[model samples]
Target: MQDLEIIASAGASFRPGDIPPPPDGGIEAWTQVAMGWIVIFATWGYVNSFGSFQAHYTSTLPQSPFQISWIGSIQVWFTFFGSAFSGRLLDAGFWIPTFLVGAGLQLIGIFMMSLSTSYWHLMITQGVVTGIGGGIIFAPSLALVATYFEKRRGIAIGLVTTGNSLGGTVYPLVVRALLPSIGMPWTARVLGFINLAGFILVAIFMRPRLPPRQTGPIIDWSAFRDTLYVSYVGGLFFFVWSVYYTFYYLASFGQQEVGMSFADSSLITTIINAVGLPTRVLIPVLADRIGPLNTIAPAALCVAIVAYTWVAVHDVAGVYIFSIFYGIASGAFQSLMPTGVASITTRLDTIGSKSHWGSYLGCAVEYTLRGAIGARESFEGWLEGKD
Candidate 1:
């Protein structure tokens, strides 16, 4: 009865073509941006830090690096793929319940991950559980923030995404400091607490600005008909595939190929993420001026070029140099992706569904390819070692 009443009240206030324009700059609107930052920090930030986990798991577990990466892979898979359902829920005004469930699952997954003793246990707790939690909230939060700003969407998104790079930076540093002294379980517990605090802040302040957009297909089939939309989605799929593979393997490459110590290699992950902070903030300012697609095209090319430069980098100094350049380019591309999607989208109500669905497909496919190729390489290495 109360739910129906609430819906009736909302309908009374909002008419089909009478929706007000986004405030673009105000206390309430900006507050949503701040809370969106926290959401990204907790979700993607945690996911981006998987390099730290990948390195540690490889050394301790009986599984190969290929096997250990599935933990991160599966986590990422769920986070992206699950967005298809969660995005539609956001469109329907289920934000509170969705946010609560996502927060609960995240806390549960991380804390349970601390206690996990085997590969399968970690896979279930960290990969599947945490991934689902992050996926459920991540897209909706971004879309909510985007709805609050029209002119400044690029910078707004860029600001929120800095949490991704920063989270990646902080978690690795925490692991480096605590892992040797306290062990993996305690380190994970501390990280879980950090996420708990961030989620609390988000739940208190963040809200959907527009009234519930209750009617729409979950999968906007019409989006597939637009050539530009199809092309944009296809481009992002390949970009994300390459980017995530680098995130997962860069530290391991430093250790295995460059003969760096564990401590030094972990620092490589830190450097890659840390250097991205400035670019994440600065590039979106440009995106807002020239347009997100204009900003993204060059940034993607720069990342691709810098990625290839890794072939020439064989020393400690060279690796650090590569990390800096790659981080800058990649950060620019990532921070602008959603804003780019928003730029192309015409309807405010469908932004959540369209923006998430395309990128989510990319993310899911990236993990699949990573697992398959990594498994093959790992098998060949094992055979050679046996001989």
Candidate 2:
């Protein structure tokens, strides 16, 4: 009890007026910023890298493509669902414990996945375990970044999101290179070790500037009543739906419609991530200068445009061009989402509302899954017409 008081006092010291102005080029400030990025990178990278695993699972398990996608979909579901539980835990000042729990689950999940020979094994290990772990890590990391930066929030979030882009680019290539040599089981174990190290660094260094008690409850349910807040959430749902649909299906579309080799289709995915990396950085910087919504609305419109263009383009070069433009637009939407949400709330204290995060993101993922299903059905219908 006494120890809790001491921790509470330390947290109280970080109140807006109490914190000293940041030092110019201060090592500590930069270090904190780096920690934020590292956490984001590790969590999102693991999440985005699902494609590599999904492809391998479908091929090895002899399941339909849709069944393989369920592995990722369930993973995404738990990632969002657990956010509500973890967010409140974070608000209570349990950041390190929360991160540690997430890291442990992720490691266990990876190991489980390494040993699995059945579909149910993959679902339990990857979908339930890793998804829950990702949720635990993601909520606190995002909340902590909010604690660290006020003026530079947009840019800071942008930098962190770039980690996801990097993971998307690198993870597929790594899996491709290793699958034939080390094989899936050993490869899973090796990547698990890498994730363990990254997450440990995050747990140790990713302390919130304002301690949990000072931040209030972890779950801020009242955020739902705000009209603008609802809009922000809705926008995020549509954005994620459109983006993930494109991410998961574009390669398959190219391979089937454009008659590209599997290797060429994979290159298109790389191109998307490559274009996304710079836009992730550039868009948020621009958002910080203009209003976040000012930047976001236009980008969302562009994504809609690109979605239709992707549907029309059946040639390799056209798909490549779509990948670049769509990737940039998607990156901009993602980089600005949290900033836009943060803007709608009057008190920053309520920003970590766990239920809202879960519902908003879960809805997005759900809609994305629906979009992918619909696109697949459409493609099959088109093929039937050609026959």
* Per-residue C-alpha lDDT of model 1 across residues 297-320, encoded as one tens digit per residue: 889899999987777777788878
Give the TM-score of each candidate: 0.91, 0.85
lDDT of each: 0.82, 0.68
Off by over 4 Å in 1: 1-16, 376-387
Error of 2 at 63 (Å): 2.2
lDDT for 259 in candidate 2 is 78
Q: Write the per-residue lDDT of candidate 2 for residues 1-387, one digit (tens) a residue.
A: 334323322322334664443332356555666776666566666666665565555456776656666777777778777775786776677777878888798789988999988998998998889888877777667766765655676787788778778767776676767777998898888778877777767766666665345655445657667565666677776565545656666666676567776556666666677678898899988876766777788888988887777656768888889888988887777777666665555544444563346244755567465534644444554324331
